[model samples]
Target: MKHLTRLATAALMTTSLATFAQAGGHANWTSVADQSSIAFGSIKKDTVGEVHHFEDVIGTVSEAGELAVSIQLGSVETYIDIRNERMIEHVFRAADAKATLAGEVDMEELDALGVGETTLTDFEGVLSLGGLEADIEAELLVARLSEDRVLVTTANMIMLSTADLGIDAGIDTLMKLAKLPGITRVTPVTVRMVFEK
Candidate 1:
């Protein structure tokens, strides 16, 4: 009985250590290089555009191929303030949607991404917006900035329609003012997520 008890205790300790190693917690993002230069283009316009990068990145990682990414939502920059405000307030409803671009990536199939080299992969995760949880899947180009750091990017991709989330596109006002085509489609949003150690 004594020997059995000692063995059980040893097994428990080993399990605890493995769990700690697996759940590697969050890391700080010290710097984001080439902010104004990082070109992020939307699928709707399909033209090369620019975006402001994260001033501070935070997230966690796990051994079971889990990657939690949290980005600052208000930091988006497409070289226009009016467009930004319209998106955050009118389109995205920032008041209702306070989520700061957080999501997780499961990359068990790819094993690992190389540092400083972008590799293509597919990811599926939840995108919370305007009190809605949208399941998103897209092809992504990922590169490791450092050992515990990564950059995830997608270009010219549709981010689902506002109607898909049961939200009005506010196209009536836009069409009347700009004299442009009605908003049958929502604009594609391009994103570059950078995570640092």
Candidate 2:
């Protein structure tokens, strides 16, 4: 689940966050896309569950702790190619659409964290998709892996509903097209994000 550990990290950094900017210069961390990931789980027929993920995720953090993240809806990987395509067209329903997050954290605290140290905190962020936005909060474990590298992950799994994402219609369409009798509206998500100075 190391890979899936990244799925909800998006929920971690995107929320109602403090806003500020550094005065003189901005120390920032750029997302390491290859090293980061996001994973989500879905239940169908009330019992059959599967885990899926997004292959492309990116974000940035500024000196002032401003964080912005993007998860390409088209990059969803469902293990099955046809299902992936179905999700893209029927569920996501957009070309080049992206789920984005915006919020702020305690950059000053993170800056002071020594390598090999970890901190736990709760954060709230706004996750926007399909023109709908929902407020989300996440408990996170942030570890300073190196002087210039940090690993951010969810301390607990997060729940997100299709309605919250404005994707309920798309989910309905997906079930109808596949002749699926049932699919759960709420999904559990986890995330892991890597940032480097």
TM-score of each: 0.55, 0.87
Candidate 1 per-residue C-alpha lDDT over 79-118 given as tens digits, one digit per residue, 9 for 90 to 100: 5666555544554446233332233444443334455555
Q: 71-120 in candidate 2: lDDT tens per residue?
A: 77778888988888878787777647677787776555444567787777
Top model number, lDDT:
2
lDDT against the true structure, each candidate: 0.38, 0.65
Local lDDT at 105 for model 2: 62
Number of the top candidate by TM-score?
A: 2
